[model samples]
Target: MIVSNVSFGCTKANSAWCVSSKDGHLEAAANRSLSPTGHLIVAVCLGFIGTLGFSNNLLVLALFCRFKVLRSPINLLLVNISVSDLLVCVVGTPFSFAASTQGRWLIGKTGCVWYGFINSCLGTVSLISLAVLSYERYCTMMGTTEADATNYKKIAMGILLSWGYSLLWTLPPLFGWSSYGPEGPGTTCSVNWYAKDANNISYIVCLFIFCLVIPFLVICYCYGKLLYAVKQVSGVNTGMGRTREQRVLLMVVTMVICFLLCWLPYGIVALLATFGKPGLITPEASIIPSLLAKTSTVVNPIIYIFMNKQFYRCFQTFVRCPNPSFTSSFRSTSKTTKPGQKSRKVETNNISIAVASMGRPSTFIQNRTNSNGEQGLSVKGSKPVVSLVAHYNG
Candidate 1:
């Protein structure tokens, strides 16, 4: 009969060899009892969905960077978000997938530490970045004059500070101050919450509150204000501009909804894992929650591409830039007109020029023709010419 050998912390029976035995027994039981098919399905589904999101985000960043016209302070934050999400998918999710499937740490101790550190760091940084984005959107939507160049600089600085915050939380695990490693047979690497050290518990709690909860609160607050401002603006405008304002509001609402759906489960799981009784949440159940946490990285790209027309247009332009045939097709479509056109139409293009002078001066020009075909100039800065009729007899 299989016996439960798990114990909390280092008891008298706990030693390197004993720990190895416990691990081996767990591995044997997992291998004998667990079906590979289910694990494979879960891994594939998570990986595919996560990769799709990451790829979309990367496409956004690539398109934005490729076109100079698309560059803006907001786009800069988006580029950072895309880069973070890409790293999460390319580095974090794969490690997670392997760990979840194998039910053990195939990698060594160092690999475990590095994986845990990077996973936490990237997750925290992504959350903080999202909060910053919401605030930036809030400023833009509210039409705050204070949201100028200096404020943009502050946003950039805030992004940098997020990285620092992430590093602060992740570095402790590397130094042996906190226990972070494989939690169970199927769990390849994570913080060892089962260890139940007071210091570890405190550290985890602090990290959770500051990194996750605080950032989420900030995001909600900023987006809330943004929605209110949008509503106020919508009440005043009843034309195309009102429609545009409503669209922006819808996009922000969608982002917040997606963020909540994707991250809430993970946050609950993290909290449970930190404080709840052991065995209350199994590793298998935690996999989905963890997958949901990672889903945010991929979701951002989808949101931007589908919600923003300008981004979509820029993406299309960037993708089609390599194909000469596509350009020819576009040109052909643009130049085509109706056949059998009758009369030539006169087209006048009115040009408005804004001239900046040291003292601020303005002038207007007008041309007029009298009944005798005499032209007159308006005093400001107008000039006219008279056409003379000549008759030649040969």
Candidate 2:
């Protein structure tokens, strides 16, 4: 009565295998495929975002590898995000662009499965990393013990757990909790939200709860606590401490804002399609949220890496002089200079001129010259001495 791989005709239109129809009978229907000319604008936009994401993540990785100043525990979490973004750019974005441009699944069924798996894996990894970063920031601000701020063990554990959680959630579809297939104009592949059966419904609910809802709640809670902590510090008369706290607050706000803007729409659309009728979200309308999610990979480096003063300095040094060794030499010479104007006046003057040319004061050190001609670079008494050698890889 019903069979797959059935021969209806000699042409390509009759080549599809039988699938379960809405009426519970096996029926043969031609796969719905789109044309290249239909979504040319969408294809171009995806291609542009893909290229930009690749470039931005590459720079983030380069900055992490090149500057020892950026190798802190918190920054390692950022690096984890960058790595995930890089994978998305290389493995998922290219295929997405290609498929969009061709207006069909050009790589066949195998490619579609791989595409869905990689995109799901890397996207989950990025979200988990964001949650970890938020928790780290919270602990730093609210911990009673001083050692909690510098705990390397916590950093290592966070990295492990973030990656493990992502793998745990994303690998289920491959193992058959649900399934991956083409979606939205027949070019892109993802978890089939339209599948309304028991197993598929359970998987979609769990995936949304664990990967999206839980992490979103955790991030919100941590940042909310952090905000309260900052507000409590306002009554204290420490101007410098308040400024530092405010800057950190701003960074965290940006991170959360970007994360919500990119993923929230996609999550809402998926949820609607999963619970409501499959016709709730049309293929053409789905393109906006998919493209929005992809743009997150590009926006991350701008907020996480480029906003930092240390990264800006390191990148500037790298562009002007490609040699890391030379950069180290410059750092060492600046640090070892004697605190007197008689022997180091020329050097001190040169340093001032350089800082002026850059149009920003050095954050690590300040120049102080006494009337008796004693000169040195130093920070405030409460601030720890940031040694150039300590931050240099070599």
lDDT of 2 by residue, 1-394 (tens): 0112111232253222223453121222222333456568778888888889999889888988986555555677888898999899899888878767766556756676688888988999889888888776555444421222234567788888988898898888888897776666656778867666788779888988899888998899977876665555333324643664677578768978888889988888887777875455666667678889999899988887788665666778867865778677557633443222110111343332111001011223456787888875544222211111111112
Number of clashes in every candidate structure?
3, 0
Off by over 4 Å in 1: 1-34, 100-103, 143-152, 183-188, 321-394
Please provide TM-scores, in order, for all candidate models, with all chains considered together: 0.70, 0.75
lDDT of each structure?
0.56, 0.64
Q: Which portions of model 2 show Cα errors greater than 4 Å?
A: 1-19, 22-38, 144-151, 238-246, 321-394
Instruction: Please give the lDDT score at residue 145 for candidate 1.
Output: 23
Best-fitting candidate, scored by TM-score? 2
